[model samples]
Every structure is written in C-alpha cells, then in structure tokens.
Target: MLSAGPTPRVSLDTWEFVIAAENGTEHRWSWQELMALPQETPMVDIHCVTHWSKLGTTWQGVSLDTLLDGVDTGAHFALAHSYGGYTTNLPLDDLRGGRAWVAHTFDGAPLAPEHGGPARLLVPHLYFWKSAKWVRGIRLKTMDEPGFWETAGYHDYGDPWREQRYQGD
Candidate 1:
C-alpha cells in the first residue's frame, strides 16, 4: 500500500533552471537554496518504457541547451547523478540538443514526490529510466555511456520514438 504526501509548489524564481534538491524519494528540495525551476517553452509528452504514456504534462526547468550554455561540456558525454547514487549517461550531442529539462513543476502545479519533483531530469524523448528521479547534479562526460538502468537490461539508448527500451539496445 502507498500513502500520499503533501503537495509541492512551484517557486517564483527558477528562470535560469537553477535548483537545489535533497535526497528524497519524492520531490523534496531545500527552501533557502531550492527554487522551482523556471518556466520554459516547447514542452512535450512523456513516454515511459513501462507501457505508460503520461501526456501533456507541463513542466518548468532549464533546457539542456540553457543549462549547458557558456559551460564547455568537453566532447565526451553527460551523466545525471541522482540521490542514492543512481546515474544515467548520454551523448554530448543529445544533451546539447536542448530538448531535455530539469523539471520542478508539472501541469501548472507543483511536482509531487511520486512525480520526481524538487528536481527530476525530464527527457521526454527517452524512456522514463533515462530521466533519473531525485536528481542532484549533471556530470557531462566525453563518451556515450550508460547508467543504473543501462547496466541492468535496459537499452543503452532509451529512445522512445524508436522504442529502444532494452539491452538488445
């Protein structure tokens, strides 16, 4: 059985996509430093490889392009580091595409813990696992790598469009 927790709220700040998250299964970020990731455009649908398609969910966070702005991500790749050491890897090019975002709010409301609020990587193009929950920081690498799901049987490239969900990858 599961229980519901308090609802989350979107911060007025967060335009630059900057956020401060803590170690939590639900969406929980510190108050003093934490702020709802700012508003964004060009939102999209979410397709979970688990056979669930949560559509038209609005989110506000920094776009991959905006986050990587000014910072040199070298030429390797990127890794999303989450609480409890969960991680996911991606090609530098894909991360640079700007489709991905660090979501703090959902559907015009604050993100609930079950929804990966406070800070969750929102990569609508990839499978849900690629969007690591309880996300903390992003480490851009120099190679197309894999993370917890990728190492397990999930696809290395979790492209929802291509239906790439498993390790035959």
Candidate 2:
C-alpha cells in the first residue's frame, strides 16, 4: 500500500462518506449507514501506474451505482477526496455502471489502515491511483478538475494498459 502522505487513522464514530453535487446539494452516509447498504464482492484485476498488477483480488463494498442512487447531478466529472487530503479526478462515467466501489474489505478481512482501511474507492478498471485510499467523499463538477497527481505531472487519466503515466505519455 503506497500513500503520498502519512497514513490517517480515522475513527469509525466520526467517519462519513459524502457525495456533493455541482449544484451544492449533498448526500451523506455515516459508517453505519454505509455498511447497511447492499454489499457486493467483486473479484477483479487491479493495475498500478508503477507497473504492478494484482489479479482476481476480492473486495467487499457498496457499488458506486448503489451509492449514487437518487443523487441528482448534471456533472460530467468527479473528484475523489480521501481522509489524508489525497484526491484524484475521473470522468463521471468512469465511476458509474458498476465500475467502482467504496470498498471496506479485502481478502475476506477488514482492510488494514495501511491499506486504506475504513474505506477506499476501488476503480479496478483504471490504474490504482485512481482508486483513492481512505476515501471520504466524491465531488461532482461540471468542469474537469485535475487532482493532486495530475497537477504534479502525472497523466490526468492514468491508464496502465495504455501506459498513461507521465504527463506526456
């Protein structure tokens, strides 16, 4: 588990996941509420921009589709925010249609803090960096907002299969 900043230990009591729309409306889910949502176990292949890959890994969580149900948004982009201030951007379409999850378990066990415990965004179709660790919320925007690594010269959309790593790659 690689993180750009110090790992944050989030207390479950205060943990919450939010979806803020471009229109300023918000949907909030506390840890308990989130756990009560329908859970799915997805075994997928994850790739990292750093040239590593994990195949058929199992994860348990609510689908982004399920989480976004009833959310009203006219946005075309999404920025994932994490507990440690880490963020990543992705096209809104990339987050829907069963493409992503707010994952809390791995390998049949609670995810360790070192591995982005509490919860993380798991978008296995994209490079792992797009899967924000310790994910706290998602901000829907009408405009594209390049995130932390994107501003640091990493490709705005890191696709391992296409090898979109560096800004010019």
Candidate 3:
C-alpha cells in the first residue's frame, strides 16, 4: 500500500463521508449509514503512475452512482478530499456510471488503514493516484480544481493508459 504520510488510525464512531455540491449542499453518511447502502463487488484492474499494474483485484463497496443518485449538481469536475489532507481531481463523469466505488473491502477483507481502510475512492480506469486514499468527501466543482499531486507537477487527469504522469505528459 502506498500513502503520502503515516497511516492514520481512524475510529468508526467518528468516521463520516460527505459529498458537497457546487450549490453548497452537503450530503453526509456516517460509517453505519454508508454500510447500509447498496453494496457492489467489483473486480477490476488498477494501474499506478509508477508503471505497475494489478489486474482483477476484488473489492466491495458502494458505487459512486448509487451515492450520487439524487444529488442535484451541474458541476462537470470533482475534487476528492481525503483524511490526512490528500486530494485528487477528476472529471465528474469519470466518477459516474459503474466506474467508481467508495471501497471499504479488498479481497473480501476489511481494507487495512495503509490501504485506505474505512473507505477510499476507487477509480480503476484512471491512474492509482487518482483514487484518493481514506477519501472523506468529494466537492463538486464548476471549474476543474487541481489537488495535491496535480499542484506538484503530477498530471491533473491521470490516465495510466495514456501515460499521463506529469503535468505536460
């Protein structure tokens, strides 16, 4: 598992996930509330910006589509925020459909903190960095906003297939 800093030991009692819309509306879900939502097991391939690829990894979580079902938003971009202040940007479209999940289980086991336990944003189609770990919320944005890595020269839209690892790549 890769992380930007020391693993954060999060307590379930205080864990919550949120979705902030461009209109200033915030939808929140506590750990229990989140687990009560519909769950899906997705087997997908993940690629890292470092050029490593893992195929057919299994995970269990709620689909982002399910989470955004009734969310009213006109935003075309999204900025994912995570615990420990890590963040990443993605086109809102990339998070819809069945493309992404807020994963809490891996290989049928509770995800380890080092692996973004509690929950993490899983966008398998993009580079792994685009999948923010320990994801707490996503802010819908009318304008594309770059996040942690993006601001530090990483590609704003990281697509592993396109080799978009750097700002100009």
Candidate 4:
C-alpha cells in the first residue's frame, strides 16, 4: 500500500447503503457487493464545499476509467447516479488523469458514512459534493444534465482551486 502520509483505518459508520436510479429504477446495494467490486487504489486529498481540504486520503475503488475502459459509450457526458435521487454530470474527458474513481474504502478501510461511504464518486479536482455518497451507478449520456447542487446554482463543473462554486463561471 503506497501512501504519502499516515494512513488511518477507514470505516463506514454502520449505516445501510442506498442505491437508486434517476429513471425510477430503484436498487439498493448490499455491503457484500460494495466490497466485491474490483479495486484501484490511489492516495488523494478531498476538498469539501464547506471550504476545507483534507489531504492524503487513501482511497480504494473501481476507477471509472478502468470500469469504462473497453466499453464504448461514445458519449460526451455522464451522470453519477446516487442515492436519494442526487446526481452530478461531467464530461467524459474530465474523468482522465486518475482524478475520477468510485471509492469504497478510504485509508485502508471501508469509508465511513459521514465521509461518503459504501460507495462515493471521488472527483478530486472538483468540490466535495461532486464526490457523491452512496453511488449506485453511472449513466453515460450524450447530452449534459445538471445535478442536485448544480440545479441549486452551483457551478456546473466545480473546480475548487479557481473557486468555481457558483454558476457565474
């Protein structure tokens, strides 16, 4: 396990995982399946919307890059399907550079719910909400669709370093 700093044992705070579809197809993932998916580990930092950055978070999960490797979506956009009907969209190219991952474990252990456990999308370059909690699946789309936060006036592509938090940019 290659890590940059002190790695803490991650934990999911004993809560059930919720997985639902935006198209009304409901499916809840079990703890077993969350643990069974193939894993690609990368040590990263998290930038929360509340204006704090947590560094050196070791995460292990199925990389969207790896999962979508051979599959030909031939589409430009995609939606991150999550629990509670929450979703965020992104361009397919943004998923490159190891920045996008479907993370299950953080710091050598299962991710805690407060930290977006069971499964969450880790788009490290964007705001934390984009790192959604309870991720079920991703819907690859040809047209761009905004998500919960985006509809609430947040930036469509939340680039934190530039303070892209609102819709102006």
Which 10-residue window of candidate 3 scores lowest in summed lDDT? 1-10
Q: Which one wins by TM-score: 1 or 2? A: 2
All models: lDDT? 0.64, 0.93, 0.93, 0.69
Task: Name the better of 3 and 4 by lDDT.
Answer: 3
Report model 2's TM-score to 2 decimal places: 0.97
Q: Model 1: how far is 106 from its true place, Å?
A: 0.5
Residue pairs with backbone overlap in model 3: none
Quality of model 4 by C-alpha lDDT: 0.69
- Candidate 3 residue runs with Cα over 4 Å from true position: none
For residues 1-169, could you state the per-residue lDDT of candidate 1 as single tens digits?
0112343333335312222212211223343334433447546888887788887777777676765555643456667776556778776566667778777677777666666656678888777777766567776555566788778777887888888988774
lDDT of 3 by residue, 111-144 (tens): 9998998789999999998998899999999999
Q: Estimate each model's TM-score.
A: 0.74, 0.97, 0.98, 0.76
Candidate 2, superposed: residue stretches over 4 Å from native: none
- lDDT for residue 6 in candidate 1, whole number 0-100: 40
Question: What is model 4's C-alpha RMSD?
Answer: 7.4
Minimal lDDT window, size 10, model 4: 1-10
State how far residue 127 of model 1 sits from its true place (Å). 1.1
